[model samples]
Target chain A: MIARLLSAFALAGFSPLLWADALTGDVQRQPLNVSAIAMFVAFVALTLGITYWASKRNTSTSAFYTAGGSITGFQNGLAIAGDYMSAASFLGISALVFTSGYDGLIYSIGFLVGWPIILFLIAERLRNLGKYTFADVASYRLGQTQIRTLSACGSLVVVAFYLIAQMVGAGKLIELLFGLDYHVAVVLVGILMVLYVLFGGMLATTWVQIIKAVLLLSGASFMAIMVLKHVNFDISTLFSEAIKVHPKGEAIMSPGGLVKDPISAFSLGLALMFGTAGLPHILMRFFTVSDAKEARKSVFYATGFIGYFYILTFIIGFGAILLVSTNPDFKDATGALLGGNNMAAVHLANAVGGSVFLGFISAVAFATILAVVSGLTLAGASAVSHDLYASVFRKGRVNDKDEMRVSKITTVALGILAIGLGILFEKQNIAFMVGLAFSIAASCNFPVLLLSMYWKNLTTRGAMIGGWLGLITAVVLMVLGPTIWVQILGHEKAIYPYEYPALFSILIAFAGIWFFSVTDKSKAAAGERALFFPQFVRSQTGLGSSGATAH
Target chain B: MHDLAYKRIEQSPQFKELVAKREKFAWILSAIMLGLYVVFILLIAFQPQLLGARISPDSSVTWGIPMGVGLIVSAFVLTGIYVQRANGEFDRLNQAILDEVKQ
Candidate 1:
């Protein structure tokens, strides 16, 4: 079915090519170099081989979905980094910092901080009750049907938003590098992503992510080092140079100089920070590990790796600022502003490091989009096949083959949907979509997970209400917020003042859970709630052994 | 298998003691997060001149950037605390849980 759909889409895209060519009067296009073609072929072969290997080993549903629950701490750690880093971290944030200066670093800081919270609070519990999806943990104490339904909603929301961002990024990169039409780029990315996830499942996704992370980090690190060398290895001097280059005596060292509004600055920070913990694709990686200790260790490694990556981005962004300020060509290029800030990092690497760096950075950027989209597809598949179909609709009776079939189908469907959205919203900023994903995740999923794990009095009623309220509040705020309303819809004055919605969603979710839990006595268990408080208290004081001995 | 693992951990005195300590630390960390979030919101709401006095416009130092840096630092510190605890106390607890599950 997916193959047929791809063929149809490809044909449609090609139909317009002849007309476009005739109108342009045969302008000679630059052909793909031998090296570029070879590299592209090699990447395809490696990814496909991994998928085939995973398919052969997946003897059961669990194996296909979660790698038979046997992943190691270090491997999962690398995979976590692979999964979370995405194109947004590798490209988007760097581009943001390159264009906006200090405000761009705020996004990096926000994402990096979520690891500690996950390690300290959520990791072990999630592993202990691990099923195929996050809803497994939330539903462990609640009714299966309720948890499954809510989990599906939350997962879908997150995956849809995240996938659109990645697809849009892929389209832009394809256009930039290969000169492909926008629709063609979208369809190509969608097909490739579906092939990766449908064939290999978790094992394939994990390996892809790990390989992408290594390449991405190494490539970015190399470029950053080279960039610093150009600056004569002077870290302090870069800041001074940046300060000297500013147009309006803008504060180079403060957030206030970056933007005019204080409220927007605070809201952006809040979205980035809290949104990391709530990301469904990220949390799902916890389940891929064998145990809780592994989960915790993975967080530690990911944090370290991610931290170093952010530091490198600082160099990359600042280097671009310096380079562009001096170069007439880059200064005249309006692509950065029109295409959005996400292109700044790539443009900088291309300009400063030459064609070799441009090709390498572009390849890594492509891989970044691929790895993240694959992860999102897997997460979405799990929510559909594992949570919704198997657990709720089929009562877990769906056999291994049937489950795999359903999951693959869902992956293809999702990929197509993502491609459609990407083309439709090509002009919009990918970061905005990413931020919306985070807001939805934090608002809808975080509260339910936190309350269920810690608050014993959290009844089924409370969980449902909290989850729905969070989902609704986040969606509404995002729709009415300035980014979508004023900027996208051209409504001069948006109803909601804030650009970020996580803060509002977080507040609404917490309030709903507390209010609902306090008033409902029938379903609430007082003793369980009391025990959780002490357990939480004890965990904080360094009393508990980190080792996950099955008590 | 699941019941046996649960029982083994529940029976271990060391595991019980560790759980208590971990819970305490969790509360403290949560409190810190809540407090930090409050201060962040306050700084955003009221942009005082004192906050920007030392941060020159030439360098891009504002209340928001410093506060963001602070959050990042604190997050790392908390992660370090978790690592120390895991290496020391939580290691034993996790081992106990694994041993029980394996048995």
Candidate 2:
């Protein structure tokens, strides 16, 4: 499928690479790179083969949603790691470290610390209770229609914000790396991701993610090892060299101006840690595993892989500062990197292993974006089909075939929506976009999902109202906050000063849910409370849980 | 399993034991992780210089570097411990409870 698409583009005499160069006055026009195109095409062909194989096994709705719960612990681990390690993290964090050293480590640490919390609190129960989406678990003991409606809205909002970030990042990165036109890159990513989900479903999406994870980990490991070898495996030498070459000098060794005040730091930390727990795509991965045991094991492996990846990224960043920043070949006439700081890791790949490695890393980076967006599209589609369409609209009367059709249609819809938004927000500062996604997940999804699982008194009314409260508060405060209001809206001062909305919104959510649940004395609330024990038993023991279908 | 089986399991001593032990264990481990993370964030928030302090006079490496790396390693190690115990001891108890109730 992708081979045909690429050939069509090639035969059309596409010249967006030259067009982009003409628009940007400083950047020189890069001739179409043969090696990068070859490597990327090869990757797409291999994944297309996997999608073909997976489609054969994707007969049932269960299979479409979760590979028939057939994935093993280790494979799911790699997929989870792949899904979490987006191109944004790979290029964005390395770029951050190259620009401001210690603060990048802080971001990496914030990202990894969320994994253990998810494993400890959510993973096993989620596997035991949910079928395809987190809404399954969130609505397990409550009013299915109401709770599913709320959860679906939460999922779509997070997915949309996250998709925009990934799409824009993918377009810009591909434009820089492969010298493709920006719009062509965006369309290609959208169509290809839709293919992975629309035909192959979760089965193929997981494989694509797993393959990308292995490639990215190996590529980063090579870069980090070569970097260490240059300084003879001495950490101090690497640090000393980085300090000498970096413009900030010793200031880069400590915390800089990236995060200014305490409130902002705490809020951002809260969002990163808890936001990870609430991400719809991450939660959906648990259902791909057969049982609670595999679910737990996957998180363990994912944590190790992700932690190791971030550490490697830290090394890659410092190495880029030491090697790429000093090289005249990597720099433009303005003394900055040709494509900007985000290209530090790419340039370092060339510096260490020449253009061949650069091409390989670039291909892996593009694959990383494709894999992540595919997973996000799958999760968002599940929210629509499994939660809203099947459970809410049909009132659980929908057949397997109809549910599956809705999800496929949703996948294409989401794919087109992502591409449209990607182009629409091309000029926007997307740094705060991911932060907003995390903040919403932290504020709305995490609070509702957590309280539903643990708090027996959580009535449907309470969960629905409180969830909306958190969602609204987060979006409103974010608009009024510094990043959007003062920076994006051209306002003089932010009504809400903090950059992150997680701290305040999360508090309001929890307090609202508590107050509402305690005050409700209705019969429906009583019935909801009565259902908690059965739900709790199923959540803990996996009794009568959906098992892996026999192939 | 039916509602009766769920009631039986809920009342069983082994089920209660598993729930109490596992919940206590998870919460404790989670507290340790979250507590450490809160402290790390606090240090970054309140006293950035403390984290920025050099480890030794001879090296350019700062205290913040090891501390950040330690948090990452700590997250991985703590999850390892939880998984080890959950898959072994907790699973054993859960199986026993299920077996008893299945009869």
Candidate 3:
């Protein structure tokens, strides 16, 4: 029965390869067989179908950007999961777990924790004040032109960094799965992503995210269950077995043993935790819901779903560690590591469930990349079309159709740029790129959003100075920091030794905002003061009666 | 109706109490988060072994599970506090503000 089951699985898995074999003479040379191609085609069709339906419904700019601002709390919540769970969540987290063990789970935790912060402090306010971009909220009291310019700059930096990271991962995955050249894969992904975003906008992006989220979560859940079944559902025994296999005498339960130094570990933790709230692409999802209540509920649901998914990742990662240790083929001819760290999850799937699960997981990972890239593209488009063009350059003269066209064009341009960068940076660590993006976003954008909502005396000059200062500080620190200056460029004696730049950038931004606010001449206007410090103050004090008005 | 609205606003003392409670909770939550973050760093530095035993045949304990669990728990706690406050207090006060602004 075992043999038959294995054989049946192999047949199901290899069927795609069999189909590909009939099309080309070079099929044997290609990395991807017929099955991967079939899967890719199917995903493309589904994505395009979504785009078509969304386009048909998109009669106005609001529909194109915010789905007519009528999406249910549940749907928006699911879409948030879709937006956040990129290739990084699926492949990146799994790979981290495979290599680092317990340390990998730390990244997942940092990411999941940020949602509550958003839910509590940012989500409702973001929905209530903003229409499309977060700039809407920040600029409500400040002048439009000032906030628009600052937000555009911040948005562009974040979107570009994120886009490059996704593209690089996509290119590498395509090369591994299809035997295509890295450049070709990058270009192919670029074209498809651009088409999806340009035609459909937010509507297409939302649906893509939802679909990918479902696929990824279901696949991870299934694999985790199967893995647990292998050990007869005994988690305690699983851990004990893992401990026995390690050559190192260190206890598997401990944290300090995983790394050689203490500082690196702390820095890594800081990067993961702070980076979660700083990401622009993720924050943009909050504006899609209708009201603050819906936004809050959506976040609640997202937190629960995302939390469970992370648990499953832990299982998958540990499963890989065991499966790879047993499999001889995983190692290279020289007995060194082969196939790179990112492929750990893929190899694990092959070992446990044969090719069927392997192919399915691979397909899901590819879809994950596509969905994230589409969202990033939409963000970039909005930065240019909405904030920079309409609010800044053209001063709101651009009509709806013209504005939409600009957005589409920007998406295509960014898509191409991402493809180019992806091919160039294929050899670099994807996590590093993601970290850099988070650092930039956190430094440049986060402070502005926070202060605008809470601080009544915040001035336009302070915001501009703070935003620019954050941007410059983060870029400069990252350039001179150990990660880029020494490691990437191969400098033996770099100026800074730390790997992550997030903490420093955040501090600089905060300080800049404070300093500028105190020194600037602009004063809070009467109307603005009221908006900044609402009548809710008395209610918050807990000394007032239960009435509609607080004052 | 306007007079009634004004009278109600003038007479109500619950708003003050609610605001005080919400602010107190916010401060507590903020402190807790700060403490947890510090602990997270400390655990990373000096007590990596605090996570749990390994699950694989190898001796390495998977940190991702513990960290992921910590984040999820923190998120839930924070969300719970926010929901309690928002539903209990902010909703009514916020409506009042909107009404005042319109007038």
Candidate 4:
């Protein structure tokens, strides 16, 4: 999925990347597809019904932030898969494979590898130690103000970049799918996501995600089956046909210069792996389950579902290459697929099924964006309310009512902010935005959160300075790197040569935190180190962790 | 009450055993996952041609495709293995430790 950003940057100028199916920046209105619109309306109606039911139970901060820890592991697994298998991964990887075959596999592998790492390293401890946001765990025994403030900042920055990327993609994808104005589509997503988080909170959002994940997986599975059926269910025949028809021929079977150097490849790998572990929304999923056992199960199921989904994407991509690319009806006058390469899966849906299946797939794409953005908004709101307002400003003394109120207000504000930024960045190339989000997450948030749970010597001074160092380094280096400096800013050459900066910045964060922490002899550092054992005991055994709310 | 519970569990052998066993399992699994990933990425970086080589020379699919798919499958299986142990054995140990601490 992160490797989708690699081709996204390459396809940055004329073809919008990830979820966008539009061929160009010009958003032309096509004949309105009544079936797509009808399915979308049905999805909206059903989710709103669930939201109405969820409102009654969302009285406590716990309910608002994590559905009162009431979610089962299986359900949480589906929701986590939903949060991850974005429309971008579905269409973008397929498009990548439809064009350059094996590289897409590499990208999907990068995306799936992160889930297992999260399961083995982070998931159980996170569920046991944290309450609302990850800041809860980071600030457990450290200086509550400094650590919480740093975490909130890191979370917000990642959230802002990620939201903007999703928003822009949603606007463009909806514009092409439903034939709506770009601004209208962006505003529609903004309003619906805000409604989901503001009223339904985590319970409503979870159900919405589950529904979308099921729809997406089923739709993709059907398409893949149809593709295999065309080749008599022989995978070798399917591959042979794809290799024969693909323009790149045998070259598509190997790496196609996606990363020219070892450094860039390793940097990108580091970002995708650790970035998934650091994501606020993904990490927040652990708290929705009842305990560490359910949390572990959640990762187990999530890894399976996500890996299955990626395998399906690979089949669908090769299927698209074999079926859709050669079909004259699916191509434009210029021989390019109508709309863009990202429409490979969409056209394949129509080629395999019909107009009706096409409508279903289109609607599922819109639903995927909505589900994803709602989760991001909730994570962002939690950063502001639970982490910053409750823990930092109120010093953990605020009533739950006040904290929940702040969360709702922050949700509305974030919705408006997302809508505005979506429209503002409509024409700008946003491939780097998601990459920047991942970089900051891997470099800044992952290091601090990981160290706090595992390391006894992670003092506030070390975490604060090192965390900001990584955050700023990731951003500045991104701007000075190839993607932005040369491509976006019209520069001759990049000052920072690498496109991905996680390799450098993550090391700096770890070393900086280690050096600062070991050098510090402050009384505060001693107190924090002294508290690590109790934290360790609870994290290991769930001794005093929050349990699921009783009915 | 909570601090006392933590202190009691911290001193107990059951807690130590739980931590040691779980930590070992977790680290070993993490290393395998990360090691496999690093090897895959390094192959992509250093030896693209080797990964591009056909599995049987007559097959249309290259070695990279199965290796990639294999990595994905292995990831799922590894998590399954971890969850199976953690939820069954380690979890029982954890609960027993908690009970002793409560006593």
User: How well does each candidate superpose onto the true structure, as a TM-score?
Assistant: 0.82, 0.93, 0.83, 0.94
lDDT of 3 by residue, A331-440 (tens): 76675335665667777777777777777777787788888888888888888888888888898888988888888778878977887787677666444566667677
- Could you give the CAPRI-style class of model 3? acceptable
Per-residue lDDT, model 4, residue A500, is 74
- Give one digit per residue, the lDDT tens place, for model 4 in B76-95: 99999999999999988888
Measure candidate 3: CA RMSD.
Answer: 9.6
Query: Best lDDT goes to which candidate?
Result: 4
| Candidate 4 segments exceeding 4 Å error | A1-29, A486-492, B45-50, B56-59
- What tens digits encode model 2's per-residue C-alpha lDDT throughout A1-551? 43333222221111111111111212233557778789999999999999999998887789988999999989999999998887767877888889989878876776677788889899998898888898988898888988899889999999998888888878877888888888999999999999999889999999999999999999999999999999999999999999998889988888655423446555666776788889999898899999999999999999999999999999999999999999999988899898777678989999999888989998998999999999999989999999999999999998999998899899989998999999998777776777788889988899989988899999988888888899999999999998789988999999998776888999988888888888999999999999999989888998878877734
What TM-scores result for chain A when each predicted structure is judged separately against the true chain A?
0.84, 0.92, 0.86, 0.94
Interface RMSD of each: 11.9, 10.9, 12.0, 4.0
Model 1 spans > 4 angstroms off: A1-38, A246-250, A259-268, A333-341, A427-431, A483-493, A523-551, B1-13, B27-78, B93-103
Q: What are the per-residue Cα lDDT tens digits for candidate 1 across B1-103? A: 2444444555667666777777678668767755674455344335434444545545444555456657766766776677677666767765655555466
Question: Residues A285-365, candidate 1, lDDT per residue (tens digit)?
Answer: 877776666777787788777777877787788877777655655543653332344556766776777766666776776
DockQ of 1: 0.26
DockQ, in order, for the candidates?
0.26, 0.53, 0.30, 0.61
lDDT of each: 0.67, 0.85, 0.66, 0.86
Best prediction by DockQ = 4
Fnat of candidates, each listed = 0.24, 0.70, 0.39, 0.79
TM-score of 2: 0.93
